[model samples]
Target: MLRLVTTSLCLYCQRAQVTPLLLTRPHSVIFQEENQLAVNALYDLSVDISKVRKLKGWVLRQSAVYVSETAALLRDMGASGPVIARVLELHPEAILCNPDQMEAQKKLWMSVCASQKDLVGIIEKFPASFFTSSSDHDNQKANIAFFQTLHLNKRIISKLMASAPHSFSRPVKQNEEMIQTLQKTYLDLGGKEDNMKIWLQKLLTQNPYVLLKLPNALHDNLAFLRNVGFTSDELLRLLSKLKGFVTELNPESMRLTLSYSEETLGCTDAELRQIVLQCPALLYYSVPILADRFKGLLAAGVSMEQIMETPTVLELTTQIVQYRIQKLRSFGYDVRSGSLEVLNGTKKDFEMSYGKLRLRQERPLFNPVAPLRTED
Candidate 1:
């Protein structure tokens, strides 16, 4: 009777809290047979023993079948002990799931991204997406169907899944409605009504997280921008190229920025529109950053038209601008006073051009003439 009561108390402690009484007092453990079996099983699980003891109830309950078959199945599927342990820790309900069902879930995710490391990475980032249930598979299928409707290539879809695993778990109806509405709005507002397929492709290229924003939220955001003096065309053009701005900027912050740009920063309304249309992302920049870039442009002898045309120059980070400008200065090329095209080129293009010039400048001057060899 005393052993029965102690066993019930220890089991209750394991279920209710962090540590079982037996785990706290190892020598006092009356269930040595079960404890040894569990401890040995979990030690090979590659998780800290101390931590595993906290989940002794679950560890032991699943240990028998898991040690004999379940774990072997995971190992056979090429999942390392650490990855399996982490999956269990994050989703302990997985222990109760059938081993065959768990194996199927692992295979499903692997099919999305063939790389085992990437599968492990997504699992680490988001274990909920890889649930072993029929509903999970249904949601994943719907998400894949939605992406397919957009006509995105398989590689891009794989990257999207790897980067945002939840993309595969979101409600299909919600994402489908949001994307369809957004596409219609883009065509109507951006003047790309004639070529929607291309516009959506461009939007996806610039912002793969397109489904992150719902249609109503986007409509509300566009309404705010329209009130802030953006014409339909300007809004469309800006959103097409600056896909992240909608997710980043809100109406309240946007109004303050518009007021600051026109009232304080001395940018005319037309100039503000041009700036945003040329670089919609500029709307998301802080007033101080916008001001600094404006001042930097003036200081560098950059023309207003040049700044308007190649607004991405304003998108460069402070460090990048300083480093590249200084590097160009060292090469006797005055980028500030020179054509703005150089500033707008990508880092790789700039590197290829400037790196060669720098190498030439650093090269030691060699004379082709050899000293005449006289008979000596």
Candidate 2:
């Protein structure tokens, strides 16, 4: 009788333990089943499943097979299997988008795009741009209409939508305010009214995200530049030269870069202005990068005067400078004694210069037009 009692107690304990486990099992099984569905769907679509798993595992936990919906949409848009797979791989969040929302986005994009082919190309290149939240659809449409009223070319608007979707995703009022600020700044700096449209288009093309910045950023930077002694005309010229990137700069960063360049180049404020005018990179490049480039040049026997004369050399990396110097040395041309202009330019330019030097060396010193004989 005691044995029977002990057996009953053991059976009750086992049931108690299993009851809790059974309760939890259904939830986990459902999650695993959903994940498996996503995995299978992606595998069928020929996507890089490993990347999806690694970069966006959370996408698999949803109950729906979003990958299939997204893939079908891409296929209907004339995207090939490889392109569809690539788009999904690059932006797995695309799978999480609602099918109806994606369809609406397709029609909205088609309005801007010349054809399905162009739309497909844009989607292939910028998946995230196309797969933005459905909630922003209204704002995007309003912004597109607003840009149209501004007389921006449809192609430029399309480029903006693809490259800077966040700008279009915002309320039209925000973009309008930013545009007004830009226009006011331009006119205040003596920009011609006749050239305003072209200027705005060029600026937007150069940096569409510029509109995303607050109007205060443009105001603050201009104020700082004026305080630093740049006249209105100089500021206008600088604005034109920067291609609308001036708004991206803040006073503190600019102050540090200016101070560093002024001290490193041993130039007065006026001279530094000229240098910045010649190479706006002096403003764009960070101080550490400038310092490294300067150190590389000075160590290579290049004088500060040479660097000032060709400020573009600062664009070249230290490794490139060293390689070019080595190539010039091989040609018996010493950069230390020659102009830094020879070191500047693209790789093709350097190769052409090197070829000329090689030809000059191969030519006989006394003979002006004699061909050199080659041994058989």
Query: Local distance difference test, per candidate?
Result: 0.63, 0.82
Model 2 per-residue lDDT tens digits across residues 333-362: 888888887777899998887888789888
Q: TM-scores for all candidates?
A: 0.64, 0.84
Each prediction's RMSD over C-alphas, in Å, is 7.8, 10.9
Highest-scoring model, lDDT: 2
TM-score of 1: 0.64
**Cα RMSD of predicted structure 1:** 7.8
Q: Candidate 1 lDDT, tens digit per residue, 216-242? A: 667878899888788887777777667
TM-score between model 2 and native: 0.84
